[model samples]
Target chain A: MHLYDSTIPSGNAYKVQLLLSHLHIPYAITSLNILATPPETRSSDFLAINPNGRIPVFILDDGTPLIESNAIMFYLAEGTPYLPDDKLAKAQVLQWLFFEQYSHEPYVAVWKFRTYWALNGFEDLSGREIQKLKERGQAAIDVMERHLEGREWFVGTNYSIADIALFAYTSAAEQIGFSVGPNVKAWLSRVEGTKGWVKIKKDETGKCPL
Target chain B: MHLYDSTIPSGNAYKVQLLLSHLHIPYAITSLNILATPPETRSSDFLAINPNGRIPVFILDDGTPLIESNAIMFYLAEGTPYLPDDKLAKAQVLQWLFFEQYSHEPYVAVWKFRTYWALNGFEDLSGREIQKLKERGQAAIDVMERHLEGREWFVGTNYSIADIALFAYTSAAEQIGFSVGPNVKAWLSRVEGTKGWVKIKKDETGKCPL
Candidate 1:
């Protein structure tokens, strides 16, 4: 299998990398600077691979294209310890994954990316926009914190892709000046201790290694 | 099984309803007005069932709550015809569901909801916000159009949950003055023809009926 990687930091893409490393899947990476203006993701070539024009597009062993970071990771971790075999437990894992994409990433991840690339720094952001991002992003983080209050992992009892999915961005919360609750912070650390865990690398631009 | 249905129009909730009716799974709905300001979803009682406080929270026969609309549908559709057994095809269904949540619903569904619920009118929206919504929402619709080209369903050869996920909102595009490509319109027509398909009903609030 081959994964089209992004040269810039991407939590969505990172989710795939973490799972691949955990599964001991030795695959190839073709890094593209998707962050560049008119992102390479928009090119016809990338578009042909993923009409959505996004990164973390995985090419299966059969050479078929699979997009969506969570979907790709779920495929890879299906039989691994990262994905539960129990049906309802499996669905709960999915619930968090969807929450990560819809509630968490949209606010937290976008804020991290835009603020990292912001030419004029956080002060340049409109007060209202900044406040909204802070409030909403914090709300998402709060949800995770509350969920982790009496639990160690997002799912039943083990670490799953649900952890990797949210860990990608939630781990970066403090770096972006977004305050994370204590429970989330502690859970983030627990994720780091998981077997086969790999760190997300980035350069001075606060982005993925090129 | 019981589903905590929402009284107001929710494309997410509608996806579950359409599927249950199609699957002929006899279940009960406890409608709550989640669209109310400080949404009823935020109430302590609703939060007990779903920490996310969203509707379409499905309770299994054992009384376990499954949140996330797509997750609930996926759970219910398991071992059924609506969800494929093939590995890769299942991922494809999930990819589109994520696409619907991340790309499509954020813009298309939100636009339809805000515009429909806007006390004044869509005209009351800020010019820049409106423009952004139109462009992003249309881009999502365009992706679906391209995918539907020469295809009858969103995934493989069958009408899976992917079709229901996108159909809940894509079908409402025209009602909001959004233009959909011919192929997308044709596919929408095809979805309606699926066996046991049920229409999403609504009351005067542009939402599901009582």
Candidate 2:
């Protein structure tokens, strides 16, 4: 497999990298400079590979390119313990994945991106916009905290891709100024303790490619 | 099956209604008054059904509540033609489903909601915000047009749930001031022509519940 990813930290891209590590799948990467003026993702060449012009486009050995990070994780985790066999359990996994993309990522990931950019000397969002982002991001975190009250993982008893999907962004919450509840804080530690787990900054083999 | 839906038009809930119509499944609905101040979805009773406070919560015969519109469609379409059997094709279907939620629905559906509210004497968004929504919504439509250049459906040769997911909001593009390209326009007609297809405001068996 070949992955068109970003040099910057993107939780969407990292979800795929984390799952690949769990499965021990080795693949080549082409890291695009997303922070570059005009961003490499919007270039005509990159857009040809993905019309939406987003990174983490995973190319199968057969040359078919797949976009969307959660979908890619779903594709990679098939037949593995990371994706359950029970129909309802699988659907529950997907429900969390969708929730991560629609509810969690938009606020948490965007706030983290803005904070990263601001720390690096670029501030685009106003105080009000940032405040809204923080509040909404906190709401998503609270949902996770409530869901994790008695559960170890997001879905069934086992740690599944649903956990990985939410963990990719939630792991960075505190750094972006959102308080992590005790349940979520402990769950983050549990995710890190999972066998063969890799940090967002590293590749599948525990190597920091950048 | 029992569905907790909205009294108003919701593309998210309509995806389930359309799929159930195609599958000839009989289900009961508890339509919440979402347009009411404070919205019934946020009420304690409805929140008990779905912590997310969102509609289109489908409950199975054994009483397992399913959230997320696309996830519900995936569970319902498991053995049907609406979801395919091939692994790669299935992944592609999911890719579009995620894209619809993340990229398409936010802009297009929000624009529609704002327009509906403004026409009904409640103006929440400024003109500038509305313009931004229109531009972003058009960008999503443009991506769909490029993908549908020669294809009859969003994924594979059949009319899978990928088409259904995208079609839910894209069908309303022109009504909300976004232009529909030729390819997407034709594809909408094709989706409407599918067997067991129902309008967004109608339930299964082709009755307008509202």
Candidate 3:
């Protein structure tokens, strides 16, 4: 299997990488320069791999390419300890996964992107837009804090992909200026202590093989 | 199962309703006044059911309330024709589901909401914001158009939840001033022709059971 990813840190791509690490699956990575003038993700070659023109496209051993990070995680975690067998449990995991993509990442990840890129002299959002991102991103964090009040994991008693999905972005909240409540902070600590955990690597040099 | 939904024509909520109608599952709906001042979805009572305070919450026979429309659809579509049994096909369905929520609905549904509410003297987005919504929304539609070039459905050989999820918003694109390409239009007609299909009923009278 191979993962078409980016050099810049992406929580969405990292979700797959984290899960693959936990599962001890060996795969090759093809990093793309998404911050380039014409982002490599939008290039014809990459678009051929994923029409959506996004990274973290996982190719199966049979050469079938799958896009969407959460979906790829779902595919990878199937029949493993990371994914529960009970019907309701699987659905709950999916609920959090969708919530992460729709509510959490749009704000938290976008804020991180804008903030990080602005430091490099690329400003994408206006002042007002940044304020909205902060408010919305904090709201998403608050939701996670409340959900973690009496629970260790997002779905059930055991650690599941739901934790992996939310952990990717929520862990970076404090670094990105969003306040993390005690519950979420504790939960992040628990996620970090999980076996076979790997840190997201930063690739400062923007270079990729064609 | 009972569905906690809103009277307003919500593409997210409609995705669940359309699936239930297809499966011939009888479920009661508790419509909330989502357009009201302070929106009943954010009320303490509803919040207790779903902390996220979003509508289309599907309660199981065991009284477990499930949030997220796609998750509810996944739970209901299991062991049914709407959800495939093949692993890769299932992942493909989810890929489109995530794409719909992340890439498609935010723009198309938000554009539709702003345009519809503007007619009733409720303006939420500024002129510039509306333009951005238009461009983004049309870009989403163009992606769908390209995907539907020679395909009848979003995933696999038959109509799955992917089609249902995308159809909820894409069907209304023309009414909101977004042009639908020929391929997407034909695919929309195919979706409309599916068995057990139901139209999204618009409740203009803003009343709901407390």
Tell me the spans in candidate 3 whose CA falls farther than 4 Å from its real position.
Answer: A118-127, A203-210, B118-128, B205-210
Query: For residues A76-189, could you state the per-residue lDDT of candidate 3 as single tens digits?
Result: 999999999899999999999999998899898887776575344225445676778889889889989998989999988999999999999887889878999999999989
TM-scores for all candidates? 0.95, 0.93, 0.94
- Residue B10 lDDT (model 3): 81
Q: How well is candidate 3 docked (DockQ)?
A: 0.87
Model 2 accuracy (lDDT, Cα): 0.87
lDDT of 2 by residue, A50-83 (tens): 9998988999999899999999999999899999
Any residue pairs clashing in model 1, and if so which? Answer: A9-A208, B202-B207
Error of model 2, residue B187, in angstroms: 0.4
Per-model RMSD to reference: 2.3, 3.8, 3.5
Off by over 4 Å in 1: A119-125, A204-210, B120-125, B206-210
The residue-level lDDT of candidate 2 at B9 comes to 78
Worst lDDT window (10 residues) for model 3 chain B?
B201-210
Q: Candidate 2's residue-wise lDDT over B1-210, tens digit each?
A: 999888777899999999999999999999997767888999998888888889989999999899999999999999899999898999999999999999899899887776664345325455665667788889999999999988899988999999999989899889767999999999999999999999888433222232
Q: Which stretch of 10 consecutive residues in model 2 chain A shows the poorest summed lDDT?
A: A201-210
Sorting all predicted structures by TM-score, with the top scorer first, yields 1, 3, 2
Candidate 3: tens digits of C-alpha lDDT, residues B42-71: 999899998888988999988999999999
Location of the lowest summed lDDT over 10 successive residues in candidate 3 chain A: A201-210
